[model samples]
Target: MCPCGFLLPIHKGETLPSSLTVRRCDLQRFLKVIRGAGLLSRKGIPAWVSLDASSGVLRLRAANTQVEVQLQLEAADSAFEAIVDAEFLKICSGKEASSVTLSLADDEVTASWFDADVPRAARFVLRSSDSVPPAVAAPEILATNEPHLLEALREAQATTDPGASRFALACVQLRSAEGRIAATDSRQLLVQRGYQFPWAGDRLMQITPVFGAQEIDRSQDVQIGEAGNWIAVQAGPWRIAHAVEVEGRFPNVDLVIPSPSSLVSSMSVETGDARFVLERLDKLPCSDTLHEPVTVELNGSVAIRSRQEESAAAVELVLSRTQRNGNECRLQMDRRYLGRALKLGLREVGFTAGGGPCVARDAQRDYVWMGLGQENTISAADVGDRLLSEESVGG
Candidate 1:
């Protein structure tokens, strides 16, 4: 066997009978995806960048006990497998060359590049090791476009708490059969529906940390599959498989969202104004006991106020419209959390405040609900009484 663990053996110091040619730009793009997968190690170890000459695939892989990321590029030629260090390949990709040629010879992998302007040729020779990376099995699941999955994941991730008491709250849950995805951090809940996938059977998959959303190429579609304890995400030439964390029983977050009929007062505001107010409020002084709470008071017009110590700030936004059953409403919630929900870029944002949770939804049905805050909670009756007292004084 060859030193690189290939079935074929090449004589000492002899050039192996396999070579592959790839454009520099394509190789750089493939490496960029691999870097995003969190696989490249800065340490000078053999990070194991592999080339399969027969299948025309170049692969870079890094894995821990729980998760594994494999990035492949189909730009190889001939029939042999060789392993080289990731740092060597990264340096070769950085050279000012239009094309890169890789060849396996004896126990070494040679990478050669020539610049169009310069007469000199730059070449790197890396000793191949016997270590071979394990093959990543492709699971039989469903595939969807990257944009749809990414959008849902981003919204869900916004509400997921990394340090939550319940493990499931830290993960983004994808229920393919139900056509919905949901996530929450106890204080807030976000659920998005209307996703169509080909796969059947009610399979519940939980993605921890939501790293796939950051790693996946937005321009490509994603192939999703679950096998045993792992969920595989194949986006373009990269495949990432993460172990499903033991979440036990996920909480019933759907119950927290108040129905439209239960709302006492509802108000609509321009998305731009809502976002601007929230951003400004985020800069105010806040404490653990008193998170900068934005109070949304619904009268004839909508007013938002936040106060800390002796400092107070308020912004009045014209309500596009409002609905009430002869009752006033006031809601206070953490301004930072509200800012994240509003930044989803919905043209118009709808807010519903009452005795139940304060719910905000966009035109796309993407809703965020904030439960009663520990420091800031006001009842609808109290709000109505205060408004009546003010009106009586004016009269």
Candidate 2:
């Protein structure tokens, strides 16, 4: 928090702590930086952190260790707070960068990004006609039906690899057939599977975001094609429509997840360690997609028959080591997509991973594993190439 009456100077080129300002440039920078990580960016992030530019109140929030510092913006004329992802700030550093820059020109937005380290920056321009942008509200790490998905995502990978790691995870592709969500980092390769939601009609196929759990959790109105990619999360005072789908092919990343298991068993979230687990995954999200209460089975264990509608979480990413009997299961998915899925749930949930991605349908049958291939070790581009090779073989 800035000093009570401290008169801090925000440099000309530098931006006011975004959480405190509603400057258009500041907002754009916030989104651009957050959107940089090529394939790892969470799709359904909150539009904006609450703030009234008219009221000079500054509320700045950037969290690490599950605890964040909010510099409440306070100005008599126009006060506001800016909520930005701590990770987004890192993208602006230009060191480990695979990001796109979003610039505004009289309400027009253009994106220029470098897909890989060696290549020059490439730009993808979206015309007002080509893009469908909802009004920009307050941006956030993960909002909407919170408390649960955040718990799950954190349980999956609390601390993202400030460095880098590898693994495959479940994924949602709006048009996986066309290629949308993908694990693009060389260190984190992603495999994906297309899922059909109960309301899936003209709505795109997607790997729900970290906030999705919450949206699905609290939503009473689950209309299908009537709603597009926008899911109106009704939790906070204001209802919000978050973007959950990506328009591309989520790589076939199933090669990394262990083969389909007939031995399906139910699991529950940890009890006391819930908060701790969430904090950890929030920081990482780079480790494999292993949620605390995810379904599992022993090497030769019997198939325990079951399904659970509600089972609170104990911890987020207890890791395979935390298992009671050294019995843990590997969740194969598009890491990017899985991280996004568990972004906004309320409490922990019951899950079962058979062989593919079936969105944790209790501990019972063979569900579709979202993706194939290894994550944390390979980039989505490489996986795409390998997929191209496989396609050639079949062709």
Candidate 2 stretches greater than 4 Å from native: 1-52, 55-76, 79-146, 151-229, 232-395
User: Can you give the lDDT of residue 321 in candidate 2?
Assistant: 19
Worst 10 residues of 1 by lDDT: 385-394
Best by lDDT: 1
Clashing residue pairs in all predictions, respectively, total: 0, 102
Best by TM-score: 1
RMSD, every candidate, angstroms? 8.2, 18.6
Residue-by-residue lDDT tens digits, candidate 2, 44-90:
53222222344544332322211111223234454332222233333
TM-scores of the candidates in the order shown: 0.70, 0.26
lDDT of each: 0.55, 0.29
State candidate 1's TM-score: 0.70
Clashing pairs in 1: none
lDDT of 2 at 146: 26
